[model samples]
Target: MLRTLFSLVISAAVLAGAYVYTFGVPGSVAAYFGPQQAADSSAGAAPSGRGGGGQFGGRGGGRSTTVVLSPIEIQPYQDVLRAIGTATALRSTNVMAEVSGEVTAVNLEANQMVAAGDILIELEARNEALNLEIAEAELAYARETVARYEQLQTNGNSTVTGVALSEARLALSLAEAKAGLARVSLDNRTIRAPIAGRLGLSSMDVGDSLANGSLIVTIDNAEALIVEFELPERAIGILQPQQVVRAMTPTFVGRVFEGRVTSFDSRVDPVTRSVTVRARIENPDGLLWSGMTFSVELSQASAPLAMVASTAITWSQSGASIWIDNDGAALAVPVTILYRQDESVWLEVDLPEGTLVVTEGAQKLRDGAPITSADAPRGRNSAGDAAAPNARRDTAPRAGAPT
Candidate 1:
């Protein structure tokens, strides 16, 4: 019986040692064993930082979690908006003949630049020209007759009576009216440019018969180009005249055209919930042609938001969250992701700028858990004293202060 009891006691001792080594000793047991552990962790054993004053303060014998802390920065976010647009010339028109006649001359070639009122096509006006000549001859004869009669009247000659001179004056006025009409008819046979622009190809030749108002050629003032595109109605607040815009086309590889917003449609389309926008770009080189498909882009600026490193974010069953160093305790703050760039994430959290957030070693932290910043200067504890070996000292300036 004595031997059996001794054996059982030895077995119990071995089990206890194994339990302590594997999972650590309980606080009550550690206190019973010695005072060294209790004294070393006394400072971190205070009330939980999260609960303001609670029993659950720290973890692992009141040891602080070592982590990397980064300051939250206020950064402006920009959303890129893209859409397809059709390009058109700043001014365009179709030149046409005003009168029916055979084409006597073609003054413009394909892609020929012409000035306003420059003659582009001339029709066969032989009959109209003959009529103008006859009218002029009659007008000259009437003027001579009227002069002779007026001279006789001034000389007080009864041979030219007042009624005869009145008849002659009426004939002279009729002759002048006919002459003006003939000149107008002759001018109608010529086609002129309505605007200064480059002309398109014309099918008319010297002998081709053209009807009145027939299309002669197309003219485009391509000194500048206009791009028409649509954007979601949600951008209405930010869409304004003179806003900068950029456009690219597949035809012009690797080239971008810069322009400014000119106008927006008065109302949004009910079906698409989009608003039409027009932008103008200078085309001095004439490289961009009308009726081209362009990829339009606009940088939509957003309000400033708090930004932090992407690795700082942690996820839970509840939602996305991040660990913030509240004083010396880890606090999990819920954040809504607004935007994500390469290594940074913009958050829609209520935390003030310059708040320290844990970028690494956050996975091992719990709310109210004591935390020590790896970035903090050496030889300081969570209490800002020279005790804990893994403590950190912050040297960064306060937020909103001049650098």
Candidate 2:
């Protein structure tokens, strides 16, 4: 009978200890049955109505949860847009022959710089030159005959009829037209650069025959490069002409090319829901090349936002919020999370910069819950500033204090 009674008492004691650990001992029971001493040795130094045994609910006005604090910072939020692009010369074209003939001379070497109207290639024009000579001879004869007939008519010669003089003038006009045509044909045999640029490789040699419109070389004006890229439709309103942009190429590691937006496609691509954007970058050093791939970046800055430690935020059905220390109580202020980076989160809220926010022990807090700092009495917040009200005053250790 004595063993059975002892077992019952031990079981009751174990259950009571578990209850006290989980929900904390009730204020009246702890005051009456627990320790009779103050929880903090320096309890007399605390302000009126503030108690040290609130966590245990022993003869205190209300429970005060200990929390770590950090001050919020106002930081400008910038969104960076990245996309892949293709580089091209400001102007590019394939040089081709205008007339069919055997190549007589190739004046330009591969990758040679040429100016507008600079002769790049010459084709066989022996027959054309001969034709032009013949036309000029006939034209000279016709003009001499007309001059003689007019002189005869002016001299009152009977053999010089008005009809004959008129026919001679017609012949002279026909000869002039023939001569002009011959000159044009001869000029076409010599190919000249249409635009000032550097020339690409050409397979033609002195003896090679070229057909009309056959590609002889390629020319590119790379003093400036054009980079074409696509941006999603969501960036339409934000992107505008002349906006600053930066580009990098894998070929040149750590090199950045600065450019500005030159134009945008008139319509968004139906399949991709994106718009093509073009930027012009100066290539003074000739480092950039056509057909090179580039990685483009555009940065857009928005309004300033309140930045806080990610651990300071709490989520509920109503939305996300952070506990602000208002006087000695906790105030849950609603906020919209704008951006997140590593351990920091930028919040869109009306709260001013440098607001004290609870970083630790947030789970134990509610609206208007009394709070105390878990840091040293003079602990500095994340912003390197001291918070008000909830800042601890007594540095002396207390019973059941958190490590």
Candidate 3:
């Protein structure tokens, strides 16, 4: 019987330890549960508040949540389309040799400005000149022989057949002489610039024997530069010739080049679903070069729209929306986004002008939940920046305050 009594005491000690661990000491447990039961009884007996719900009780009698608000306004908006393009010379060509010969003289230097038909290279032509002279002498002898034969036939000293034969020989010699002249002309062998522009590096040097059709140099007309870019097929109807465009390149930072739309492709690319567009920019100082990439911006002015801070917009399963203050209660209003800039977004919504929209602390709000603006004095919210106090209203219920 004594051993059984000792076992009962040990069991009682184990139960006391578990109770202390789970609920703290008995006095501490009473301290924790005492206030909570009294607070619940008080909140149930109180009248409904604007916040509409208690922190842990049924709807109503809760403290208002604080949020930052911004007033809705109308602002001028412009739609802009951005794209990348390549800059090219208005006119460019690869100058080539028309005839083959040894380069006896190089008349042009690299990066030289030249006019059309300016001689660039000359080839040797002494042998061609000699052949031309010999052909001319033979033609002269034939002409004299034909004249003599005609005169003899008139004086009855030569037969008609003899005069005819002499005439035929003269014709044959004339043909040979004309052929020699053409050969001599080809041997003149001078390569001239086809168009006026700046020249690139010469491909052949003095004494270099070049074949026909070989590259001589490249020339580009830089009076005007062309930028070619692609635009979506949907933009075909909106684009027009002579529309203003702005372009920028990495090579020329902080400088924008203005241009006008010059032309567009007639057919849209099936693979990309885009159309090629060309714009012309004047380059009088030759600052822009061919094959450089440029960032292009095209803008179109439009009517004013409602504008708000981009941070005010929030997305959910329903769609994009923003929280607005209605009689000191949080109300979510859906909006359709129209355009967006760096700091602001233009939207299409039916909200009245001067409506206060929440820009911060929106996550703690529910429909019809009481709210206090961070701009308010007694309800200051640390999560949001303070704004004009006149913009905030004190319409929500507060803790430990009259109804």
Q: Which numbered prediction scores highest in TM-score against the true structure?
A: 2
* Location of the lowest summed lDDT over 10 successive residues in candidate 2: 39-48
State each model's C-alpha RMSD to the native.
9.6, 6.1, 10.1
Error of 3 at 172 (Å): 12
Model 3: which ten-residue window has the lowest total lDDT? 382-391
What's the residue-level lDDT of 401 in candidate 1? Answer: 66
For model 2, how does the per-residue alpha-carbon lDDT over 289-334 read when each residue is reduced to its tens digit?
Answer: 8899999998888788899999998999999999988766678899
Candidate 1 accuracy as TM-score: 0.74
Candidate 1's C-alpha runs over 4 A off are: 1-24, 35-55, 58-61, 66-68, 157-170, 302-304, 309-322, 332-354, 359-365, 372-403
* Model 3, span 229-347: residue lDDT tens: 99887777678899999999999899999999999999999999999999999999888888899999888776678889998999999999999987666789999998888989999
At residue 88, candidate 1 shows an lDDT of: 91
Candidate 3 error regions (>4 Å):
1-50, 53-65, 76-81, 130-188, 231-238, 267-274, 314-318, 326-332, 340-343, 351-354, 363-371, 379-403
Q: For model 3, what is the error of residue 228's alpha carbon versus the real structure, in angstroms, after optimal superposition?
A: 2.7
Ranking by TM-score: 2, 1, 3
Clashing pairs in 3: 52-60, 53-60
lDDT of 1 by residue, 344-371 (tens): 9999999998899989877777887667
**Residue 303 of model 2, lDDT score:** 82
With a 3 Å backbone cut-off (N, CA, C), the pairs that clash in candidate 1 are: 376-393, 377-393
lDDT of 2 at 254: 96
Winner on TM-score (1 vs 2): 2
lDDT of each: 0.81, 0.80, 0.76
